[model samples]
Target chain A: MGEFPTVTDVARVAGVSRQTVSNVMNTPGIVKADTRARVEAAISALGYRPHASARRLRTRRSSTIGIRLDPMIDGISGSVLDRFLHALTEQADARGLRVLLFTATSPEDEISQFRRLNDGADVDGFVLTSTTADDPRTEWLLEQGIAFVTFGRPWRSDDFTAPRHPWVDVDGYSGLHAATRAQQDAGATRIAYIGWPSPSGTGDDRRRGWHDAMLERGDVSAEDLACLEVVTADGVDQGAAAMQQLARTAGGIDAVLCASDALALGAMIANPARVPVTGYDNTPIAAAIGLSSVDQPVDEVAAAALELLAGEFEGKSGAPSDPAPPPFRMVTPRLITRQFAAIPRDSVPVNALVSEVSR
Target chain B: MGEFPTVTDVARVAGVSRQTVSNVMNTPGIVKADTRARVEAAISALGYRPHASARRLRTRRSSTIGIRLDPMIDGISGSVLDRFLHALTEQADARGLRVLLFTATSPEDEISQFRRLNDGADVDGFVLTSTTADDPRTEWLLEQGIAFVTFGRPWRSDDFTAPRHPWVDVDGYSGLHAATRAQQDAGATRIAYIGWPSPSGTGDDRRRGWHDAMLERGDVSAEDLACLEVVTADGVDQGAAAMQQLARTAGGIDAVLCASDALALGAMIANPARVPVTGYDNTPIAAAIGLSSVDQPVDEVAAAALELLAGEFEGKSGAPSDPAPPPFRMVTPRLITRQFAAIPRDSVPVNALVSEVSR
Candidate 1:
């Protein structure tokens, strides 16, 4: 690469003094329009992009926040991530906070990467997504004394006694309830619940909501319902197998509620075309297929995350919680249904059709 | 966030001097295992993530790279972005460089974002994705003398003239020609090409390749074997509509080639159960469904992008390129055929389909 144009070069190209270039940058309106245009043209012509972090260090305020994602989570559907990323982008834009993206190949890499960025002063604070039950990142952030907030809920005891970190999560329990209610409203009495492992906080809540909704209806009992724990690799094929297994059980299930759209897609490929399914995370694919799903307010989650991060940055430590806890704040999920789950009563029943989930 | 424990705090908690904590951080092996464990426990308890940027600035050798994605470009699916991102993550991990993500909401915002990061010493160089015709961001980088590389062909005449700016792009024409020949080899005489807008360099090349291949095979007259352009949107519905329009005019073509898996998906959904179609960009769905596609070596693209950026940073200015026109390096695309495109000639007569297209 050739030598980058220095400020003097910009002045030369713009045919203006260096002071004028500075004025055009920091106080553009103050400069004459013609002069401003010239400077801008020169800037564009020269490919003059400024270095942000160095300027931030000098100014002591970057207005940029660093975000970390787990590589394992990257393999998930693009549509779901698009929603979350969109939300984050919209909120960050409004707040004038730039996002710094970092990916950790493994859990251990998390600490080293965080250290690199933190020491560099490349960001003001941190925003973390997709945390596991026993998260080390949270604990590490707490020790570093960095101002940070997470997308998922934290598992800590005696909240006040533990290091306080703010977080915002979708109310998965309520979302599941809404999904089940939508299916039941569509005339589904024998409903089946397909969920993820309990280690995932949101997944656990969804499973609970499904059972609670079913019990409240009193149309089906624990023995009548089937729960499928989905594994990660080959999710679609495994989902198809689980659907077939659920169908073989004594009274056939009418509607199925899936924890994720990926699982829902799998179930759709797995289920007999006649058997309808419900899904959570109204991902783009779910919309494309017209699958009924619970649409968690991704925009709301992103807004709340930014607000929490801003609050922490503003020196507002953990907020007051209900009497049962020291720190507390929660957001709820919304339900959205489409053609797939809105089956008519006159439609052929599962047993009358293929009598099994198609592999 | 509370006050983070300094080196002193770790030392105090571990019953050692402050230098001991510092030593434990720099060289864990130097410290006794028990002492190191105590320091580690203290570090974990205190959340002590190191700030690498701060040290790097002082050392003048920070291992970080800047990334700028326009929200518009990033939002587009089937654009080779997912593969690029994945490649960036893997290569960056191997090279020990962290990515600092930033968004340029508009062309004007590009300058400030670049200056803010670069001047602050946030990164050593940058990888730019999805530049439009006559891009201002590219121009500004050229003027400022920053180090950067793009993933697509540049619109400006003087782009390659700028020593510090470089680019790497897919060899679309070759890939499209290969797909066309593959279709011919499958015993299909009536082949139709469905592609996106030709303003995209890749799309233009693919279109050209299709024309050339059809000419060589004499499958259809020059006027009959024309390439149809389709607009990109949310789902395959639009793709289905476009394909239906082409199918109606072309007397139900036998084999079709698509620009992306998303488009191919739309085509599949349009017919639902039967259709012989091939797509470019072997995305995950292509593999899952076993649809034939051209796989642009994403890992190679990202590695090349990084290498281009590194060259610029090292002041080499121009990346290696073909001396001939087109002014950019072209990486070849590999063909991957799956079950969807594996239709046997016996299933559908080639002469009949050709007669339909000729009409």
Candidate 2:
């Protein structure tokens, strides 16, 4: 936080030549103990600290943490992983660290990359994202005693297995819970949920948020099970089709909440009758289209993750000696309400929409 | 290309043990000249290349390239930059090189960061994005004899300077030229262009695309100049507002084109009639809403940039002895058509849209 202690400062305080200070700092064993002691005392008295980079040099570490960029990008509109990488790099820089970006075809291949990079001393640790059920990479990293933190909730193929690694995730359950409760407060009676099919912890947790909120309202109906819940693949098309199906089957759905902005965007596009719609992940598209959505504090999540993985968790957790899981962080999410506009019209044919309309 | 030639293969061809081949390769001068010549002959005979990493270590280069991530991100819905980064990482990995991600507060600050990282031998070269007029960083890089290639066309602020470095940019001029011609082909005589106000090469290049196509149609009128071109600051709101302005000034505008999907999305949102709208950077939002956009083959740009910067350009163009600017590549762009549908009404109130109603 203050000016870095220079060799000149040390020499001035210790009444020694700058070379002696440099010798004491870089090769302390070569210096006479008393002279080295005097220089060290002067450094402490002046409240001067050496450069962090120099301290890391003594450890023979690269002072760089590696992050793997998945070869496949899911949605261009929701580059949550990219945003996390951005924040992590900035936070790492502030700590005199750098980010090493690598790519791997799969989780197993990622383990190999970790081995290769570590063997070459190219990276000291890693940051993981989009962890899935029974993640093989987690297992491999744990076996190798590699240092890392996941930006997703840990899943072990079963709920009984407690997480064994450090992780930081957006609290989607609470985010959607509040979103649904807000709709209720705003006089929505029959709320429907549109989300991905289950078995994924993230999807299930978000759907639970809506279910619990509707239950709290005592507006839960048996029809909610068969008629309301629409579980489909992820995308605006799936979401729109799901909403259309829900409208055809069940009559009185008033408010809709989606697991993603993609779903909400789709729902908004196909909304036959005007309906209040909310989406998760307040992506730029959601904002552009004026859809209420949950905003994950991506920067905070990255900072917390770097602090836990690269700063503190490295020394304490995810170590082979301690086979227990590290404490996890659940970053709170916020809601942005812009209220989607109704586009109440049948879609025109793609070809006819753009034609020789005389100028 | 071929199976990486092993020491065994070289030794077998040289009629020597693998250990002798290894020693000859590592410490050739220490080995007898006759034996070294034999090993060298065998290496050539087998098309054997020494480990690139070991060669890099001997040269004291990190075999890593730097890419600067601006502290602020523009849009989540169309992270063209993020996509470009993803492709670059994959391509770099293929070349036994890694990418170092850094952040900077300004273009000038990026120059300092480049110096800092390079001084540490952490990176051997750089890939610059978003190059703008009178880019101080580019000037600094050239003056310092740093190795780099930009992913954007260079500009000297005066508009007379040819880009003075190796670069790979999508042919936005051609992409938009074709897009405007498509509209012209479709019978829309009066077309409007919405883009950023500029001395920027990208903005200017795209504007020229539209202007040129319109010129091909006939002599462009003064009224056409005033009403058909709208340039403003970036954002959906600004774009929406700009399109509204154009609509008010010029009637019978049948088609619109934008420099970015954000602007096109805005223009679509505020559409007073069913006008064919197009956007650039075929982002996910463009696909979701079916907005026709120009697709910049990002993967191709990344590959071409790395090919020029890290591959051939490194050895041939950026040598300290030769200070001339390297060659640049312009990958062709493609147009994707997905006509946007008309919403057909003013937005309903957020509350009114949520109220319970009988079907």
Which lDDT values do the candidates have, in the order given? 0.63, 0.74
* Real contacts recovered, all predictions: 0.16, 0.26
Any runs in candidate 2 off by more than 4 Å, and if so which? Answer: A1-57, A156-162, A222-224, A312-325, A345-359, B1-56, B76-78, B156-163, B311-320, B323-325, B348-359
- Cα deviation at B25, candidate 1, in Å, is 13
For model 1, residues A1-359, the per-residue Cα lDDT tens digits are 11234567778999999999877655554788789889877865664544543344334355778776444332324445545665786578678787776777665687777776666566678888776667888777766656688877785553334435777777888888877787788798877777765566677788889889998998876655544333343254555556666767535777777887666666666565347776777654455445667776777888888887787766622321223321335678777655443322222122222121110
Estimate, for each residue in B1-359, the C-alpha lDDT of model 2 and write its tens digit.
11245678888889999998977644443677678779877765654544542233334366889998765546633488888888889999998889999888877788889878755657778999998877788787776556788888776542224557777888888989999998888888888999888776888899899888888787357567557888887777676788789878876687999999888877876786878898888776676667788888888998888878755335522332444446788888888877457444366332322232210
Worst 10 residues of 2 chain B by lDDT: B350-359
The chain B TM-scores of all candidates, as shown, are 0.73, 0.77
By lDDT, the best candidate is 2
TM-scores of the candidates are 0.76, 0.79
Per-residue alpha-carbon lDDT of model 2 for A1-359, expressed as tens digits?
A: 11234567778889999898766644555788689778867755554434433333333366888999876445633466676788888888888778999999877788888878755557777888888888888877766556788889786542334667778888889988998888888898788999888788889989999888887788767656457789998877677788888888766788899998888877876786878888887776665556788888899998888887764335622222454546678898887776456555365332332232211
